[model samples]
Target chain A: MNLIGLGLVGFSALLLLLFSIAKRKSPVKLRAIPALTRLYRAFGLSVEDGTRLFIALGRESLITPNAGAPLSGLGMLRHLTERTSLSDRPPIAAAGEASLALLAQDTLEAGYQAAGAGEYYQPTTGRLTGMTPFSFAAGAMPILRDESVSASVLIGHFGVEAALLADAAERENAFLVGASDDLSSQAALYASAPEALIGEELFATSAYLGATQSHTASLTVQDILRWLIILALLAGAALKLLGMI
Target chain B: MRAIAVVLAVATGLLVLIGYFIPTLAPIQSMILNWAIILSGAAALVGVFNLIWVHWGKISRREKGSLYSAILLICLIATLIFGMLLGPDDSNMRLLVNSIIVPVEATLMALLAVTLVYASIRLLRRRANLMSVVFLATALLLLIASATLPFGEIGPLNNFVRPWFQHAWALGGARGILIGVALGTLMTGLRVLFGADRPYGGK
Candidate 1:
């Protein structure tokens, strides 16, 4: 048995439970992420202006190691859908994978239902853009162009093909906010996107989107675990420097 | 229904997770995974139908871009028919894929190279800060260093600067980001297993 792995899981679950309880007493004050804040504002502006917001959930399978980013994208979709439910043009979620498209559809439905705007929901609001990475980017370009999209969010798995979507958004003069798990995509977006969240910041979508205290609890557990990992790495490096085993 | 779904998800997740430490439960995990794969395949079909339905609405309603929708639907039907008739391994199928999909993707890649160059220039025009200049210079150096000139390769850059910047600096930052992403993924996964956050339509 991998005892260390089991230990880490147990520790994380314990921290999660503890924080979930603590959250009811007082709200957790999270460090602000400016890019995410701007993304929220842009979506709000799209609603106010009677323009659509397009969320491009990249073509990553739910079963893959890269599923986290796209799942996070879905979480954000739910929140955004609720926020934009009463708008003339509801937000559109375009995903690359078939299963993800289905989930996106479900999330949108749930969001609208929660907001008491279920009658305004349309299945077409959640789209399956394409099956492949480049094709997905190609398929999504038209939606960004033709849908009266005032703003777009690319918060999924993308590689160099992100440049194409960015270019499309650029041409359309839409506000672009992108975040991805892949470094290549992140770097490209850093150059093109006005607001781009790098690395693990992609996972902060739900916490920043007015999600439940459970989301905040998870963020706290993640922060604590991050510090622990950093300390372990530092200790290991120091031991190596001292010629210790 | 929500409670049942959450219980099933948590139970299945626990079983699969426990299967890791208990060899006896491995088969149960495998069986559940097989079911998941089948569900995903079925979901893909639903997705294709959704695509067709959306485009059909656009075409029927004569939306502004309905022409594109018609073309897409025609192409999609043709591809599906050809693939179904001859199967994926047939030479004609290979020809169809190679002739259409491959070239389209390659063209996209070519466009991406141009787009990156354009974006780099625009980055300079927009940001123009100290970090932006350094970013632009570093990207240029790396691109030039990796290329072969008329005379020969840039030996000093390929040998020294490129390696140092990539391995010493970029790699460190990348590793740090990766560790953070890993932690975040773990937390997200745990949230689902714990039913803290449900992306499957649960409120």
Candidate 2:
């Protein structure tokens, strides 16, 4: 890794720790529904009873220093599953990566146990949808059309092919909420014009939705470090212009 | 277990981060990178197994498009056997994959370019007012600029076509967008850190 890459990762880790601490102390509430959330809810309203909440997670680039998006997205799935347990409804999670699918199973099981709905938890229910971006989209899109999907949330590392799924959700009048920090993926989901959280925002989703200490700690470290970096860059530029080195 | 995972995740993260800044840490960085690749590769194998199991069920049940499943199974087994037994240096299996898989994947991706153009055309056809017209014009110009053109001097047109569209306008806008994205990412991170949002399990 180069300096820029190191700075990016260290800064991200520092922020993760900060956010985690912050989450431990104070949990933020998103009182107003984000536009995508609202759109998804509206889509859900038209669906039939017993329709499941479908979530597709893509782990396209986990090797990259920033694994925040998929990790946080997993956290969100945990939150969602807990919420789902309170109701008579069941949700289906379609994971793009097999490892994530296994994690999702555990997370969902944990959520159910926490909510005292452990009886309803099934390993087969949580599925590994597909591997490639196109294959996953192709597989998940059909669920939206043929099966009654009340609400759909795609949170993780996805590619432009997400557009197909988003479009399918829209056509079915199913609620669709998407969050991806990757720039290329965001561009593909234009019709939904998803209210995406860029880069570190993906890391913050768990804290944003459910206040985790790890997240808070990271967030805090990031803020302080970023400001320092900005200041240093400005000073350096000024020094260079003045030939003071 | 949770504590261990957190500690390990953070430790690996820090090591990788430091590896970027210090030349001496390059080996550590390389090791981390290797681990990441290994982990993902392991995950891919899991995915392949899942794919095979799912498709095998479809085949047994005589599900629609089971022919595709058959093709997939045949290819998967054939490729695995050839590559594993004959070795990449000796087998023609690698060539088959390169010729077939690469071209098909590339062609599928090329379809996206067509989709974008089609979308633009659809939007233009349903123009209701001023905003639509501007969008249509922007789309058209962007398409024209992105299309392959020779570097040979077509006078002022070439200058305007490449620089204004590609370098000055697009590049500047892209750079600005990236910065904005970075800032937005930073804010979201801050929000999480400050406990303004709670998406995690333990409040």
Candidate 3:
């Protein structure tokens, strides 16, 4: 048994529990995510402009460690699908994996069902563009260019290939808000996307965009844990300087 | 149905988590992971079929770019036939992978580098923030540091500053992001396991 992992998990569980209790007593205020805010505005603009909102669900597999970002993307998708259900052209969700595409379709259907528009839910709106990153980008570029997309929200596990899609959005003059868990992709996105989520911010979509209570509590826990980690790193540096093991 | 999915997810997740720490449960972990791999492979086939269907719809409807869709189908069928008839380990299959796939992927990667440079130039115009400036400057420094100059062997800039920045600053930032991603993954997984966040059609 790995004692460190166990301890970490235990600590996280405690923080989660405490945060949940605190959240019940008082609402938590999180720092604004500009990208998410821009995305919300883009949704409204798409409806007004009579254009489609494009959402890239990314290239991560459902069972990998990288799935976290795409799962968060799905969380945001739930909110987006609901808000844009009545639009003439609903949000177009493109994924690199079939499972994600299927889930996205289901999410759209569920959103429509919730909004009393179940009959209008079209399966083609959520599509699996390609299984590979570059192919996915290639397939999605035409949609961004031809469909008159008002905005593009890319939240997923992208590599260097993210630049291809981001560039396409720029050429089409679509508002872009992008984020990824991969550091290099995040850096690339920071340059390409007018508003980009950095590092941990990608994980906070549920709290910032969806406003889910548990997700808010989870964010609180994440913040506390980050502060703890920073302190520990600082302490370790000090100890190393002092010649202590 | 949702209840069954949630229950199954929770149970399987717990088992996997437990298997990670217990030597006795390692086999169970492997089994589950193998099942996941198989499922993913099947899903990949589904993705291929979905791609074909989408393209077929465009062709049937005589969409504006239906010609491109037809080209895609022809290439796909040709590759599939060659792959099946000759087998994956055959010389022809290897030649296709080496000649076509490798070069295309390499070209795309090369394009990515150029795109990143263009994006960096536009970063200033886009945001004009301190972070943008820092990002651009760092990128310039790294690019210059890694480049092979005509006057070889620059002392401090090449020897100390470049290595320090690459190893220290870049590595530190990457590690920080990795940690955050790891923590986020853990939290998200736990949430799913506990049925708090459902990606599978539940509230």
Candidate 4:
């Protein structure tokens, strides 16, 4: 097998092994991510204020390579739905793509079923705002303005258009926590969002927020792999300096 | 049942994942990817219908700002009919896309640049941290270095500093983020492949 393929299989095997082990063990202590902590606090604030919470699942398509962000975002959605399912106004999810929107709906329904509040679930709570980036931003702007949303969590694959949504949420005085896998979007979020998740933190949402064993194990694996990569890079640089290669 | 979905997901995922390495399995991967794309496209159509249902409900109930809903419906139907009749590549459809959609999107993008500037300026006011100061400084320096100087270009600031910052510092950070994202993507896909995470419907 080629290096790329070998790497993929090796990593998958490692992740699966880690996941199985994690499932059998007690919860591990994870480093606190301020943004995730803020998000959880926002959920409580939404409940206390009796205001709606809005989540922007972004416009990434599930069939494409860019599905990672939305998938990670859904993990957060699943966790949020469990807490907010019984609220008078449950969290509303707005997605850029249709499949993500449908999945978000299913996730909400599943959350309600798990909570034994399936009758309270409404398909309308999960909305497919638009198919395109700017259109999605435009579609979501009205909801942010009119829905009395107290907290807005935007996590997914966002482009430069994320600024528009962040600005809208700011205008509405909503508590905002934004994260994205896109660098430019992350930079914009750093500036726009009061709390922003940087780099690998987006992937750790399920671990920190949901406390899922699989997600936590995957995160631990990611950390170990990241350290290994850093060591490799450093060694390569050192070898080059010594004219070894 | 959920078990069937998990089995299908694992099977298809292995085929596609293995296909990435083995040359002979490429065709199978391509076919599966194509099927997925088609299914996603069909899902998008369902989303459009969902959008229509939502707006229709708003209009029917005479909800607040239903005028906007009515306008959206009219525009959607008009564009849909126009595209269907003349085809997507036709001059009329292109005109509609170029003249209306592009300009609105461009305006929003332009607005984003201004918003970024505003946010950068206000960063310190919101949180007076070292990162905020560094962010503001870098943004201002980048803006100034990239701009025309009217008289002439500054030497160190325009040449060495900006280039080093852009190519070395900025590029390094971007690469780091890319690596992190790549790792995250692999783990997420692996989760689905192993049936530990079922995003299709299961818990």
In model 4, which residue pairs have backbone atoms overlapping below 3 Å?
none
Best by TM-score: 1
TM-score of each: 0.97, 0.71, 0.95, 0.96
Q: Comparing chain B with the reference, what is the TM-score for each candidate?
A: 0.93, 0.72, 0.94, 0.95
lDDT, ranked from best to worst: 1, 4, 3, 2
- Give the Å shift of residue A41 in candidate 1: 1.6
* Candidate number of the best lDDT: 1
Steric clash pairs (candidate 1): none
* Winner of 2 and 3 under TM-score: 3
Model 4 earns a TM-score of: 0.96
Instruction: Using lDDT as the measure, name the better of candidate 1 and candidate 3.
Output: 1
* Alpha carbon lDDT at A180, candidate 3: 92
lDDT (10s digit) by residue, model 3, range B7-28: 9888887788777777798899
lDDT of each: 0.88, 0.63, 0.84, 0.86
lDDT of 4 by residue, A45-152 (tens): 898878998999999988778888999888788888888888778889999999899998998888888778889988888899888899999998888887789999
Q: Which digits, one per residue and each the tens of the lDDT, describe model 4 over residues B57-163?
A: 88999987789999999999999999889999998799999999999989988898899888877788877899988988898898788888898878888988999
**Chain A vs native chain A, TM-score per candidate:** 0.97, 0.79, 0.95, 0.94
Candidate 3, position B110, lDDT: 88
How far off is residue B103 in model 4, in Å? 1.1
Cα lDDT for residue A69, candidate 4 = 90
Which of 1 and 2 is the better model by lDDT?
A: 1
Q: Summarize candidate 2's per-residue lDDT along A1-245 as a digit string, tens digits.
A: 37676566556655655555556567554434464456345434533355667777775444553444666566678777776655545777777777777667677787888778788886654667666667677667666775567678778878877766766776786766667766666555433423344444455555555555554454465556657767887999899999999
Report the lDDT of model 3 for residue A122: 82
Task: Compute the interface RMSD for each candidate structure.
Answer: 1.3, 5.8, 1.6, 1.5
Question: Considering summed lDDT, which 10 consecutive residues are worst modelled in model 1 chain B?
Answer: B14-23
